[model samples]
Structures are given as C-alpha cells and as structure tokens.
Target chain A: MNLLPTEEQQQIVDMVRGFLAASAPLERLRPDKFGQIGNPDAALWPKMAELGILGLGVPEEGGGLGLSAVEEALTYIEFGRALVSVGVLGATLGAHLAARTMPDIAAAIMAGTSAVGLATPRGAVAGDDGIFSGEFHLIEANEADFIVLLTSDAIALFRREEFTGQSERLSMDSHMRLMRAALESGKPLSWSSVKDGIDHARANLLIAAYATGVAEAALAGAVDYAKVREQFGKPIGSFQAIKHKCADMAIAAEVASCQVSFASVILSKNSDESRFHALASRIVAVDAALKNGATGIQVHGAIGFTAEVEAHLFVKRAHLIDFIGGDQRVQKGQFIGADAVI
Target chain B: MNLDYTAEDEIFRAEAREWLDANIPREVRPPDGPGMREFDLGWQRKQFEGGWAGVSWPVEYGGRGLSLTHQLIWYEEYAKAGGPNAELLFVGCNHAAPTIMARGTEKQKSYHLPKILSGEVAWCQGFSEPNNGSDLGGLKCRAEIVGDELVVNGSKIWTSSAHLADWQELLVRTDPAAPKHKGISWLICDMQTPGIELRPILIMTAPGHHHFNQVFYTDVRIPLSNVVGEVNDGWNVAMSTLGFERGTAGMLENIRYGAVVERLVDMARQRLGASALENDDIGQRLAQLRAEVTAVRAMTYRIASRAAIAPPGSEASLARAFFSQLQQRIRRIALDIIGPDSIELPEDDPWIRPYLRTYSNTIAAGTSEIQRNIIGERVLGLPR
Candidate 1:
C-alpha cells in the first residue's frame, strides 16, 4: 500500500541527486561550441560509472549492485532533473541487460572499462544476429567502447570501432552527441532475437520507465521556477493560469511515476500482470512527457523555447523518446493485441 | 505498487460477482439501446435491493464497509457483468452520502443516510451558479437567516439530476456583507419546498437525456437544522465534498471506460474485415486510440495505487483531467472508425448517442479547461 519510496531508496535518491548536482549540472551540458557533436562532457561518463549507477539494476553476482528497476528509476528521475544527457538512461538500461546475459561484458561496463549507447529501430541499423550497420545517432558512440543496437527483432552489442561511422553535430540539445556509423556485416559480440511476446514487453517497460523519469525531472524544475519567478507584483505561481498548468504537469508526473513503479514491481515479482502494466506505463509515460514538456515550455514563456534555458533540453529529449521503440502509433497496435489476449 | 488483490479481497470479489449474477435480472438490464435516465434509475434501485449499493460506504451506513480494493473489484465486476451505468444516483452515492457521513449531525445521518442507501431518495449537486462555475468562491446564491428557518433566494445552474432528485445539497450565501468565500452555508434543501422550481435544461449533447437542470429558489424556506455543518462555515463542508469527489472512484470509472474502449476496438476489428481494419487510415487511428486508452488505464491505475496507500488529493486531479481528455479522444476515434455510418444511424442506434453523449463528459464534471488550470496551479505550482 505504500507509494512513497522506502527509506533506503530515499537515501539512494539523495545520493544520486547530489552526484548530478555537482558533476553534471545543466549549465555544463549546454551546446556552446558551434557545429560541435553532443555536449563534450565525455569525462562525466566515467564519474557515473564510479558512482556505480551504470550497474544499478545489474545483479550483484554479475559484478554490480543489484537494485530493482524501481530504485534504478529513481536514479534516472534525478538524472532528468540534472539535465545531464540521455546517455545516463541508455547506459544504465543497456548495462543492466548486458549484465544479465553477458556477465563478462557487464563487469567491464560496471567497472567503467566499457561504455554503451542505445540504438533503436528508428535510429540505426537493426537486424538478426545483432548484425546492425548504419548511422547511429546520439551514439555517445564516440565515448562508448560498445553500442547496444536495438531493432524491432533483436538486441545486440557491437564494438564501437568495428564499423566506420561519421558524426553529424546538431544544434539542438548540446548535451547529446549524434553519430552515423556505416558497417558491412559488423561483428556482433552477442545477439538474441527479442521473443515475439516476451522481449518487446520488457523493452517497452524499460523505455516507459526511462521516459517517466525524464518527465518527472522536467516537471520538478519547472515548478521550482514558477514558485520563485515573479511577474507584476507576485510570484508567477500565484497566478491561477500558471498554477493550473503546474498542477496538470504535477498530476501527469505523478500518474506516470505511479505507473512506472507499478510496472517495476510487477516485473520484479514475475507476475502475469507485467504485460498489462508495461503497456499501460509506456502509454501513460509518453503522454505525460509530451504534454508536460509542452506545458513546461509554455510556463517558461519565451525563455523556455530558447536554447539558453535547460527547459528546451527536456523538450528535445521528449521528442526523441516519443518516437523511440516505435511511436505511439506502433505502440497502440501492441496494446490492442495485448487487450485481445486478456 | 503491486495491484494484485489479497486473498480476502479476491474472495469478496467472487462473492460480489455471484450475488450480482443471481440478483440482477436479465430483463432489468439496460437494453442494448441508447442511454436512458429512467432505465438507469430502475437498475440503480435493483442494485440497492440486492445489497450491492454503496460498496465504499461504512457498514453502519448500509454499505459493505469493504476496503477500497474491494470496492474497486466490485466496480470491475459490475462493469463486466454489463450492469447499467449508475448515472442516476451518481451524485447521491459518490458525493452527498460521503459528505453527510463526514459532517452530518446524528439526526441528519439517521434520516438521510438510510434513504440514500436504500435508493428511496435521489440527490443532486448545487454548487455551480450562472456566474460562478470555475470561480466557485464568487457564488452569489443567497440564504438569509429568518427566525427558525433559512430563506434561500438564488439560482444554481448545471445541477445534474435536479429534476428527478428528492434533495439538493445546496450552497448559499448566509452573510451577504462577508467576504465572497466566507459566510457561505451548506444546506439540504427539500426539492418539494415552497418557492422551489426546477427547470430541466437540455444540455446540447443528447436530445432527450436531461442529465442537467437549472434550479431556482425564490425565498424557499428550509429548516435551520438542515445545515450539514456549522452555520457560516459551508465552505469547509463543500471543500470536503470536493475532496472525495476527486479520488479513486473517479479513477475506477476511467479504468472501466478504458476497458470499454478496448472492447470497442476489439469489436471494430472482428466485425470489420482485416483489410478494412488494416489498410485504411482507421488502423492508424485505432492504434492511436489504443495508445490513448492504454495511457488512461495506466494513469488510472497509478492513481488507484496511490489512493490504495493514502487519500488521493491534488494528484487525482491529473488523472481526472487525463481520463477526460482520453475519453474525448476515444469518442472521436470511435466516430471516425464508425465513419458516416455513425451519424447515419437512427436515433435509437445503440452506439451513436452514447458516442455523442461523451461530448458532455468534459463539460459536465468540470470543464477540461478548468482541469488544466488546476493542474498548472496546484500541481505545477504555477501562477494562477
């Protein structure tokens, strides 16, 4: 019946929040250098690895701290608030999966000896046997020793240098770097076809959890701004118009958080309910991130739309997630299919 | 975070389902037809007689006194059983009864609680006025204290179920000179009282379904003892009512509707051939609808999970608004899939009017715009 995080979980949250506050403040991630690939804070990746966050969800036997998805999700929530980069989410989940299936590689990832990036169907090459070769955008690819390439059919790991790639720097979201890799039969360290029913369900749940964290952070930052920023004679938060928007954002964030948490628990328990919870969480989390991000921009007025504020970072990240692992349209078909089975 | 029912709760659910299956007659079920108020009322009474009413109310108040989980299970079963939408007694069961249980004097509880539970007396809400819908504090409905009776002279619009309701949980200004929010009183007004007139207002959606009414009071005299709480402190009472009005039950309703949307999508797929379902743009639209429905289901469960652990407050508002939007989206998608055939059906067509009736959902409880404002201010800590 408890919805609040456990005392231990709260301690972990405080630690993560503090770590991000000091090491990867939003200001550091701003895209200042024109034509530069993502934010050049490649140094921070090792710091996170040192914090053991990359292995947050991996089993202790697999050379990592074995926390449940719920605890890992809280870590990502703080990550969202810090506006560090999308790499945090990708690296953590990828490390978790890799550790579960490939222990040796997982140990390397946890020890900061290896870094991984996530590439979905929309972004890079995807196919059987982890044989993926294409321009993988936002690869953190330059820094990662390996990349976790996700396709509609399978998830596989690839050596970063095994494929020739070009990095195209973009103006939006300086905190993230984009790369395009070209490969002719790139070597696959490991590849397993995502089962028709099982893997997609798990992937969807993980993606939803990540999106929920992002939206929550965006919401908290916007609310903090509204409460302090003043217009006319009072704090902007005192105005009903602004208050209502914040209220809606808060509501969305709360619902999304609840759904993600529920899904995590279901997964941990290995309950039959996981499929329903996973689908529901993805649907709700994506909607919340989209709507909450838009509302965040609106509340920030002109500044939120500009590159100077970190609000746009949240917005850009939301757009990226919106299409990842199949957009709302594709996700809907899966939901209907699940419903029929139920 | 876990949504699995406890063993006891699961047993209770089975008992409830069996009881409802045996007691609720097949003939009494709302026909496969358009929404009808009279039919809804008959079904509500049937639920009352079967002891399936007020699953959330305490046993002392003639309810099952079950935990919220049990209540949710009851609702889920009721919806699955194809039970009638209990729209007729919604205000009584959802709002007024809870308010009375919380704040009513012993006498008020003794006289009203049993009748409300027994389906002997229906109730309607009297909160919104012509000028003060969202701005509830600015309500000008006046009630002057006179001798032993309170003389009420004001009007309330959008009062759902007033025409047929036996009682109105009315809010009126007791002290005109006091601040707008202060000096208001919450009174239980007998609908048959002198100088009371209920004008049935036809909300634009369904032509014959009179779900809303305009209630006018011209010096209607009610006993001073009818006040639910302390005099000049009705605002507190109203706030308490509004609090319960926004909780797990609302979320349950949304989840139920989400299930209905799931069924609709399924029906569309089965009846329409695969090519019709997949080839046309309807497939994309249905897919989006599925996503929206899933979102609504997830958000509702999220609220339910929170409320399962604690009393839901501002958080419920988010789920409420999200569900409302999702409902509208589902309705639109349903119409789009049904295409022109939806409108071309006769008025008696089972789905058309219900589809049209959903237009009132956002406007009825609280406008979607109001919901957005609440989300921004209360949840987001934004400016008013």
Candidate 2:
C-alpha cells in the first residue's frame, strides 16, 4: 500500500497548485489592517469548469474529469491552501450529487451556467418527509442559484431564493460568508441520503484533504515567518521555543496529510472501512488545521492577529470548512468503536 | 496513491502469517536479567532457525532479504500473532548488524553479522557516556593508540545490558585535540576485556530487574582492526545508521501499537461495559488516541512508500517524536482504564509496566527537544 502519489496524481496536484497559486495567492489574504480582508478570490466558475475542477469527481459521461476521490481530494487541498471560497466545494458536491441521479442539474453546475452554495442546517430542521422551514447557515450563498442543504442524514438542493433570509453581515470568514437564511416552505429540487447521495465517505475525505492543506499552509507560513522575522538579535526560529512549536506544527500537518491521503486511497478502493478512515482523517486533519492555525498566528506575533499576514485566513477557512463538514465530535460518535482497528 | 496490495504481497503476507502462527514462542519473555537475555536470544535464534531472522537483511548476511514492504508484513503478522518481544537481540540485529553491513570492514562483517543473525551473541550501544546523552558528540570517553590496540578509558552510562553483552558498538574520543564532533571513533569493544567493569543500574519501571548498566574502563584494550571506520571519523560512521532505527521502529511497531490501542479499547469496554465509549472523558480520550495511532501508521506508511523515490530524512524524527508521545498517551489511557486495580492489589498488570516504562520514551533515542531541533532545522529549514 504505497502512499506516494502516482505520477498522474502528482501532475494533477501540480496543475491544481499552479492554478490556485496564480488565481488566489496568499498575498490576497494579506490585507492592510485588522478587520479588513482582501478581495476574496471571486469564484471564477467558468475558469474552474474549463479546468474540470468544479465537477472533478463526476464521471466523464456526466461531463466531469471521471477522476476518483483521490484526485478530487488532492485538488481540494490546493483550494484549501489558497483559502478559496467554499463555493468551489459546494459546487463540486452539488455537481457530484447531480451526476449520480440528475443529469440536467449536473450539466448546468459543471458547465458553470449555474452555481451551488452549501447550506448547513443551523436549527434549520427539516421533517423526515423533506419539508423545510427554519434558520440555515449559508456558505457562498449570495452568489449561487442553487443551495445544497445539509441535514444530518442527507443533502437537499434548492434554488437560493427558495430559502429566503437576511445575511449575517459580519461573518468570521468574509469570503465564505457565514449567513443565516430562513427557509419558508421548501421542497428539494433534488436530494439523496448522505450515504448514497454525495457518498459521505468521499465527502469526508475531500474535506479532510482540504483541512490538511490549511494545516500545511499554516506550518509553511509559521516557518517562513520564523526564518526572517528576527527577535533578540537572531531569527526567532533559532529560539528553541519558536523552533519547537514550528516543529510540532510540521509534525501535525504531516500526520494530517498522511491520514488524508490514506483515507482517499481507501475510499478509492470502495473499502468497507472507508467511513472509518474518513472519520479518522477528518478528526486528525481538523485537529491539525486548528492547532497549526492558532500556532501559525502566534508565530507571526502581533501582525498575525491583524490581517497584515495571511495566518488568520487559514484558521478561518479551516473553521468554515469544518462547520459544513462534520466536526470531530460528531464524527467521533459515528465511527469510533470501542474495539478500534486500523 | 494506490493502496492496493499486489498478489505477491498478499502471498508474502500469508506466508508471514502462517509461519508466525506456528513459530511465535508460547512462553512470555522474562522481565530482565540473565533469564530475560536468554529468552530474547532464544526467540531470535528460533526465528533465525525458522528462516525468519533479519527479515530485511541481504541474503549474503544470512537474512531473508525481504523487501521493505514484506518486512512490514512480517512485523504486522508477528505482532498480530503475539510474538515474543525482541529485547536483547534488538541492538544486535536492528542496530549493530546494519551498521556493520554498511560501514564495517570485511572482517567485521564476517565476524559479527553471522553471529548476530544467528542470535549467538548480544550487542549493546555505548555512544552515551555519563556526560553525553543527547549531546553524543561531547563524549569524554577516551581511547589512546597503543602498539596494536587502543587503550580505552572513562565510563559509559545507560549501556543497556553491558553486563550481558558480548560486544559493544562503542564510541571513544580518539583524537582529543580535534573538535568535539571530529575526534570520535566507533569501535566494536569486547565486553569481556580486562579492566572493564559493569555496574547494573536498577531502572524505575521494573523493580529488582535491570536492563541498564554503568560501565567503567580503567584501561580497557581494543584491537585497532575492531574500529568500524577511521579514527576521528566515527561520528559520521555512527550517524549513518541512525535514521534506520527510526524508520524500522516506526514501520515495524506501528501495527503493534495499533493493536495496543485496540487492547485499550477492549479494556475500557470490560471496565465500562458495552457503553464504554458513551463515557465522555474516557471514551473521547480513547477515540482520540485511536486517531493518533492511526495517523502514526499512515505517516509510517508514507515514509515507506516514499522510500523508493527519496532517501529517508528528518521526517523520521517527526514520526519518532509522535510515536513516543503516543506511547505515553496510550499508557496513560491504559492506567486510567485500570484505575485502582494498579495500586490496590498488586497483580502483574501489563498496562502499568509499560506505563512506567513509557515515561522514558520521550527521553530515550533523543529527547523530544532534540527531535524538534532536528525537525525545525533539518526538515523545516529553520535557522540553526
């Protein structure tokens, strides 16, 4: 069981990294001052579609790259590193959901003619019969025609206006703007059970992969800052305290990335243990992301608290992704067995 | 990345599983002392006789010469079958033999490798002097060039099993005038040499049992030919084989640690009943430990998978540090699970022993601090 990326996988990572590097550089997150974020990388849908990133997991017959979850995960990590809008994730999952059962919706989403925003139910409970009317937390909701509604058991798609509500003007992450939407009388345009719909296992794998990127990005940011940002007549990195913290960050990110990659490979095989690995990947990756994010900001000193550095962006993105994707506690309950096996 | 097993890999795994199922010693290893040494050596000899010794060593050195993947399979199978611990033989087979193979002269290899693989002799490391633990280069152990041999002086501490060891992979200050790091020499010092003394130091975990000794050399003599590499160049010679231990330990024992977590889970279940995981504190900690150990396995696998593409690096330190810390965590969890059973009626509690032993995990090999230094400087490329 090799964990090394195949040559083709390497090429895919390079391609995604290259696109993200050019499109949504970390410099964009380096705003002038506190409370001011740089212009969020506009979800340039057409370009993403042209690059076949929006519908990465859908099959060729569904007008996608026909790639497995491994490729999709590798690509999503780049998006995470870029702190790209969760709209990309919403669109990808939305398109994947459509590809499984609804070709027309898939085509529209994949072609960039239509977009999907992810709506995580926030006490926005829907009945078992699929009727919805409550407060829903929204991600990339303002720019989307469709919304992928996340219930505990399933994901339902609806027109954005169908869930009419006021936006939370000040969200933690401005790019993936967190909002509260009140849905009044909504029936799903399309929906599926989380198990069969978007394949929850694959979903967790992708999200974990994204978080790993954030964790890694934080490590890199901290290390880079430690290298040049001097204190006490030497680079702060030379200090054991800073050095050890950075080292721990590196280890955390490394462990997170390894598990993410492993879970992706397991999902690729359609293993019975896929859910197990996915849950584990999520737990470890999120832990790393959060830990590294906090540590990264600390390494940047006072500037990290300000938007003068991109440290805050990674942590925000990590939290935002984690909010939509299951948190560690939720996943732990689902997949944690007393008699654990790997 | 593909985790699909090749047909050959499956066959290899099956072979390992079958052999280990039959041959893994039924007797538990003795805790320490001569009997413990004999038990360990006997087990190694059994594996050697069964054609399973040195699973990754080359054929020329009397090993199976299995691929890294296959060696991992063997390790997993061995651990799964509840194989006896490879304690006394550890330094000989994993550390000394590999070093001899890589850096030793033809005579050294022919003299030592066969006996090590055949489990006829035990080896111990003497790099750490009383003064030089983490700072191994700052060692004060001295060796003077005499007629045809070197006269060794000073003492070595934490030389595990020096009282029992046949030979030692010793490091001495061969060129005192040279720099601290530059003047060292790596020698295969015979433990039976005259003027050498061993004072077994009782360790904390096992009462009345000792694996460590403080060895004094008033004027121990060692043959010049016993030096593995050039005098004053032994630091490099010694260093060449370090990452190997880290890599091998992480890969081979990760599966066992995973099982250890499972055992902890089972212990938690027995104590808390079916809803063991429903208990907030105990349950969450166990679950988190599982995740951490799984990560270690994944990280270990990543290192192995990348071995073919790139040489192993400071990444090994990350795994080492993580794994060592995990050991402490798991043991802590195990203690919490056992609770008063550990202190109430003194039974041979498996978990408590390891728990006490694990306190030394972060301290041994290199301190967690040293590992971080390596990671920050070497892997992360931070300033020295």
Candidate 3:
C-alpha cells in the first residue's frame, strides 16, 4: 500500500502553502489590525474565491472547481496554518453542501458575496414558527450572512437576518469569532438527512485536518526556535532535552498529518470504516496538536507565553478546535460504537 | 495514495497465510529458553523449506527476491497467524545477511547468504559495549592486525542470542589512533573462535532467558579476509545494518500489536461488560488506541514506500520512536482496562511477561532519547 500523496496532491499543497504564506499571513489574521477579527478579511475572501478555494468543495456545475474531500482537507490545512477564521470553513462547507439543494446560497458563497457559519445542536432549538431560538453557540456567526444548524440527524440552513438577538464573544482562538444568538424567525434554506451520525463524522475528519495543520505549524515553530535560541553558549537544539522534544513534536506532527490524509481518503471512498477512521483521526489530531502546542511553548521559554508569539496562538487554536465537530470524548464514544472490531 | 494491496501482493499474502496456517504450531510456545531457541530455529527451517525465507533477498542468494512490499505482506500474515518469534535467527537473516549482501566479498556472500537463508547458522550482533550504550561510535572493542590475521580483544554486551549464535557480525576498532568512528571495522566472527566466550545475562522477567548475553574476545584471531567491508570503514557498513535493523521489523510488530489489541478488546468486553461502552472515557481510549495502531501502520507503509528511492538512515528513527511509544501505549491501555487483576495474574500469564518487557522496546534498538537525537540532527538538520 502506498500511503504517501501523489505528485499532484503535493503540488496542490505547495500551491496552497505558497498562497497562504504570501496572502493570509498570521500577522494579517491578528484582530488588533482588523476591526473585530470575527469578520472575514474582506480583501482575502475575493482572493480565496479567485484562487478557487471557496469553490473547491462545490461541484463544477455550481461554478466550483469540483475537487475531492482530500483537496478540501489540504486547503483547510493551509487555512489552519494561516489561522484563517472558522468563517472560511463554515462558508465553504455551507456553499459546497448547498450546491444542489440551495443554489442561491451556493452562488453567494462562490461569488464571495456572503459568509456562512455553523452551530452545533447543543444550545440551538427550533420553535413552532421554524425560527431558531435558544442560545446558539455559533462559530464566526457574527460575520456569517447565513448559519447552518447541524443537529444529530439533519443539517439545515438559515439566513443571518432571521436572528433577533445576537452577542459576540471571544473564543479561545483569537482568530475565531464566537457568537451567542437567539433567532426570532428563521427559514430553512435546505435540509439534508444524515445517516448514522455521518455528518459529524465527516466534520470530525476536516477538523482533524485543521488540527494537524495547527500541530505541524507548532512543531515547525518550536524546531526553528530550538535551532536559533541559545542557552549556555549553544543552540538549545544542541542539548538533548530540547532536541528530543523537537523530535517528538516532529513525530507527532507527521503522524497527525498522515492520519488526517488517510481519514480524508477513507471518507471520500465512503468506506465501511470511514466514520471510525475519521473519529480516530480527530482523536489523534487533537492530542497531537495540544501536546505539540504545549511543547512548542515550553521549547520557546518565556517568549512563548507572551501573546505576541505565534506559539500561544496555536495552543489556543488547538483548544478551540478540539471542541469542534464533537469533542475528543464524544468522537471516541461514537468511533468505538461505529466500528466494533476493537 | 492507494492503501489496497496489488493483485500480486494479495496472492502472495494468501500463499503466506496458507503456509503459516498449515505449519505454525497451534499451542502457545514458551517465551524463551532452550525450547524457545529450538522453536525459533524450527520455524525458520520450516519457512526456508516452504521457500519463504529471505523473501526480500535476491533469488540467486536462495531467496524469493520479492519486493519490499511483498516482505511486508508476509510479515503481516505471519503475525496474524501467530508465527513463532524468529529471535534466534534475526541477526543472521535480517541484519547480518543484508549487510553482507551489500558489502561482503563474493566468497563471504556466497557462503554466509545460503547458511543464513537456510537457517543453518544463527548470527548475533557485536556492536554495543558496556560503556557505549547509545554512544555506539565510542565503542572500544579492538582488533589489531598480526600478519595475515587480526587479533581481537575487548567485550561486547547486550548481544542478544550471542550464546546460541554460530557466527557474529562484529564491529571492532582496527585503528584506535584514528578518529573513533573512522577506526571501526565490520568482521564476520565465528562464535567458536579460540578464546571467544559468552556469559548469558539472566533477565529478571524471564528465567533462563539466554537470548541476551555478553561476549568476550580475548586474543581471538580471524583471517583478514573475514572483514565484511574494508578495514577501518566498517562504520558505514554497520550503519547500513542498523538502518535495516530499525526499519523492516515494524511491519510485523504493528500486525502483532493489532492481534494483541483484538484480544485486549475481547478481554475488555468480558471484564467491563456494558460499562466498556457506557464509560465514554474508556470506550474513547480504546477507540483512540485502535486508531493510533492504524496510524502507525500507515506511517510504516509510507516509510517503506521510500525504500526503493532512498536508503533509510535517520528516517527509520521516526518509525522506531513512534512504534516504541505506541507499544508502550498499547500495553498501558491494556493494563488500564485490566486494572488490579493484572497485578495478580498467574506466574506464566501470557500478558504479564510482554507488559513487563514493553519497557525494553523503547530502550532497545535505540533509546527513544537517542532516536530523537538522530531525528533532530539528521532528519531535521539541527546542529549536533
């Protein structure tokens, strides 16, 4: 079995990496520069659409590039590395999923004229009038032109104007814009019936990809710091303690990346073990990101703890990403039940 | 990339599964001792007779000359079939023969390759010295040329199967005045050479485990032609041996871990009942373990895929470190589910010994610390 990516896949990764490195750098992602970071970078959105990232997951007929899940995953890895707000993921997923069922929303997402956010079912509820009520923990909802409510059994879309009460909140990751909102009146743009918790399973797979990206970035930062940071008249990396930690972070990042890629493949294939593999990928990705993030900070010494450094940003992103698409415990329980082999 | 086996690989796998199923001893074999040695030898002989030995070796060398992927398939099938451990023949067939094939003289290759493939001569490595555990380059075992032969002295420790080996792939200091790494030479030493002695180190976990030993070479002499590579250049040859040592074995190890985990799952089901599922924490941990196992296997395949294009060096260190830690994690999870009862298992309980021995996985081959250093310096290009 050949598990390494093909040349084309690698080129896609390289292109995305280059694009993000040049256009959507972490410095641009800082909220201090932008007024309220929850809002999608107005200039970056059109560039993403121009680069075909927004249309990546959408079907060709919907004016999209019609790439596969693996491509989508690769794109998200770059997004995570750049600390792109979850609004991008939310909008892309919403547009892609709505291509056939909700054409208007798909067109808006593809044209970069609208943003979409997703909320889990935990604090969200639908009233008699089909209005979304209750305090919905929305991911980048303030910036979203529409919101997709994902429940255990169904996925429904709603316009942002339907919400009556909304309050913005700070998430662990400064790049994310969390919102608590009450919808007075809402209408479903479209609803897709999910099977056997497949929606969350799939989301977990993408989240895992993002988490792997966070991990790789964190590890690279640490290794870079270890090489240049001097201690006792030598680069800290020359010391076994720091060197091994960097080695461990590298291993974790590589494994996490592999797992995410593998899971994306299985999910695309719609394999019998897709859900289990996806959940497992999420678990590994979460653990690796958190561990590597902490280690990256420690390797950076006191500078890592300061808000100015990128090390702390990754750690915060890892924490927030862990809770997305079902937390570690939730995914684990579902995974074990889904595939009963072990 | 594709994870599906090719038609050829599948056929090979099926053939291997059939051969192993028909031949592997059904009863659980003793872990170690004289009986275990014989058992390992017998298994190797059986594999040779079945035309399955040295599948990765060239056909002219009395091997099947299959691709590395085929070797992986065979290892997976062997582990799945619960094949007996080949501990006694590992150094000969896996490390020594491969190194010999790469660097040995035609005569050395013709002689040692057949014997190793046929399981006629078991081999042990003589690399580590008591003072040079992870610092392998600093080993002080000396061999001075005297006329047409070399007089060898000094000792090698933690040489597994040394007491039972008929030959040894020994690394000795040929020019001590030169740089430490540059002075070494790789030699094929006959275990019965004059003044050669073995003192088995009894492991506390397994009684009569003669697999690990310390070998002393006092005034031992061997012909200069016995050197596998040029004198004083054995460092590169020995590195080649270690690269093989770290890489291939992980495939079978991953499959073995899979089998053990399957059993562990069954055990968890029996002991924890509905709670195994009801307890989200325990259930998730189990799921995570299973996922991690698959990840390690994927990592192995990715690493193995590079064999044709690149010679494995510090790259193998990544797999080595990951697998060692995964082994420990699998055992820890198993014990977590077994809990207090695990401590009170019968003296010969199947799980107890391996769980106890799991600590050695990271320590042996190279400590996790050493592996990380190699990875950081060689793979990551960090300063030494």
Interface RMSD of each: 3.6, 1.4, 2.2
Please, what's the RMSD in Å of model 2?
2.3
Candidate 3's residue-wise lDDT over A132-231, tens digit each?
4555677777667888765433456777766556777887666677876665556667655445434445667778888888888998889888889998
Best-performing candidate as measured by DockQ:
2
lDDT of each: 0.70, 0.81, 0.78
- Estimate, for each residue in B1-384, the C-alpha lDDT of model 3 and write its tens digit: 666777888889999999988998766675766676677777777789999988888999999988888988888888877887666777788788889999999999898899888877788889899999899999899999999899999999998878777899899999989998999999999999999988889765643355579999999999999998899999999887677778775677776787777676677777777456635566667777877887776677777777766767777888789889888878877777878887776876777767777888989878888888889999888899
After TM-score superposition, what is the CA distance of residue A169 in candidate 2 from its true location, in Å? 4.6
Assign candidate 3 its CAPRI class: medium
- Worst 10-residue lDDT window, candidate 1 chain A: A33-42
- The CAPRI class of candidate 2 is medium
Q: Sort all candidates by lDDT, best to worst.
A: 2, 3, 1
True lDDT of residue A19, candidate 1 = 84
Pitting candidate 1 against candidate 2, the one with the higher TM-score is 2
| TM-scores, all models, native as reference | 0.89, 0.95, 0.93
Task: Point out the higher-scoring one by TM-score: 2 or 3.
Answer: 2
Give each prediction's DockQ, rounded to 2 decimals. Answer: 0.43, 0.69, 0.57
Residue-wise lDDT of candidate 1 within B309-342, one digit each (tens)? 6667765667777677667767777667666777
Per-residue CA lDDT of model 2 for B1-384, tens digit only, reads 888779999988888888888887777777877888798888888889988887778998898877777787788788788886677887888788888898999999988999999989999989888878999889999999999899999999998888888999999999989989999999998888899988888888745467789999998999999999787999998888788777765576677888898888777778887464654578777778888888888887888787756657677888888889988998888768887766642555577777888888898778999999999999999999
Interface DockQ of candidate 3: 0.57
Candidate 1, residue A215: Cα displacement in angstroms equals 2.3
Off by over 4 Å in 3: A30-32, A35-42, A61-63, A121-135, A149-158, A161-165, A182-199, A340-342, B206-208, B275-281
